[model samples]
Target: MLFLKPPGVYAPQDDTSLLTTALHEEPLAPGARVLDLCTGTGALALAAARRGARVTAVDTSRLAVLTCRLNARLAGARVRALRGDLLGAVPDERFDLVLSNPPYVPSPHPQLPRRGRARAWEAGRDGRALLDRICSEVADRLRPGGVVLIVQSAFSGVAPTLDALVRTGLDAQVADRRYVPFGPRLRERAAWLRTQGLVAAGVEKEELVVIRGEAAL
Candidate 1:
């Protein structure tokens, strides 16, 4: 499907593809409700819509919301695109499937970026600023027998994510993993990552993992 990403909006990348692949593996019932958090360019949302799911795409960035809406239009897909903080925009709604490729790159800053391109990829120091919130709050927004698929780098503590979901009464596991070379941001922070012991000496690649959590039946 055709997608247009503006300057500050994130383009569909490896994480997005990984989550989309996992989405296809799900046994979605007819007219399943799907929520795409951090829906940059609306790629995943459109994918779900193509499968006849009612899709909602959410992002905090106005540019991202606009990009997603435009992409959905271009794909001839029906998607409700909204601008709000993660999970905040859909408090009154529940979904059968929730997909997110949230910011998981460990950054030197202790706080998330308020604006700019970095906002698309910069999480807190350990990259869990947004992730932790998702794990803790997403369960409440999931319908019974629903599922959530989230993609993050191994550097951001995959075990914690699994444990978090489990604590929320969901059965969770790693649905997919891909070893990818460090991108420009991660490469630039290689030294810091090494200092923090997140990567082994001379390591230039990281594993991207898609974590799937299923709500109780």
Candidate 2:
């Protein structure tokens, strides 16, 4: 499930840097309520925090949370990092902006990516299980007009993810997108990649979907 020797820290990968940059580009308020899901090493959370947002970052790994706090302090970001899986740690919190780069690998077998956090890189066979859960639950924790920004693989079939959002009944659209390279492959994973037209797409510069529909009524 772990790929790097320094498993607890995020030393900057291509995708990671991309996500961080996107956060820097968001037009959030100086004191925006921000929620960062599966916050790895708190990179995005830290970025948002530095922008003056009251950021709350969540991660299931104890090491990850600690590392996030460390990263935040190193970056001088005022972020609240926690050790909890998904939304477990913050059952009663709502935010103006929610961000996550969840696990979307579609494999029945339980295996971790050899590059990033293992828990942050694996999903069900369709790779939509966690993404589905997050999409559906996000509305419950977002204020009206709030935004949910996420990064998932094109290989997971972007359409299905959008369907999940529609099924959740939230208005959403792809705001920013870019091609990202597939790091490695698991059994049949490449086939799934091809099915999504990602194998030839060469990882596909994923995206940051912005979701904020007319009040989740």
Candidate 3:
């Protein structure tokens, strides 16, 4: 599928691919409702739509929303693209599956960016800004037996995510993990990560993990 990403919109990358793989593993019945938070290029949403699921993709960036819509159109996939903060725009809706690849890179900045390309990857100091939000609120938007697939770097606290979901009465675990060399963002933050003890000395690779959380039946 052809995706047109304007400047400032995040292009699909390893995290996106990993999330898509996990999405495919789910049992998506025909017409199952799927929600892609921080949808970016809408790759996962389009993939779900192609599987005969009804998909809705949400992003905080307008450019991202437009890019997702264009990509969905190009792929001949039906997806509702909305521009808003994660899970905030669809408060009344519940879905069978929820997918997210929200910003998980630790940023030098203490707060998330209000705009610009940094918003695509910068997630405050610990990179848990958005991840925590998802863990806290996603269960509420999931129907009984619904599942959520989320991808994040190991630098972020994977166990915390699991604990958060468990506390919310969902079964959560790491469904997939891949070791990838540092991307440009991580490479640039190597020094800070070392200072923060997020990375070991001279470590150049990080693990990307796809976490699956299922709402109680």
Better of 1 and 2 by lDDT: 1
**Across residues 37-93, which tens digit of lDDT does each residue of candidate 2 receive?**
988777778778878899999977777788788777766668898887688789988
lDDT, candidates in the order shown: 0.93, 0.69, 0.92
Q: Kindly give the stretch of ten consecutive residues in candidate 1 with the minimal lDDT sum.
A: 1-10
In model 1, pairs of residues that clash are: none
TM-score of 1: 0.98
User: Global lDDT for candidate 2?
Assistant: 0.69
Q: Compose the digit string of candidate 1's lDDT tens values, residues 124-147.
A: 999999999999999999999999
- What's the count of clashing pairs in each model shown? 0, 5, 0
Error in Å for residue 129 of model 3 = 0.4
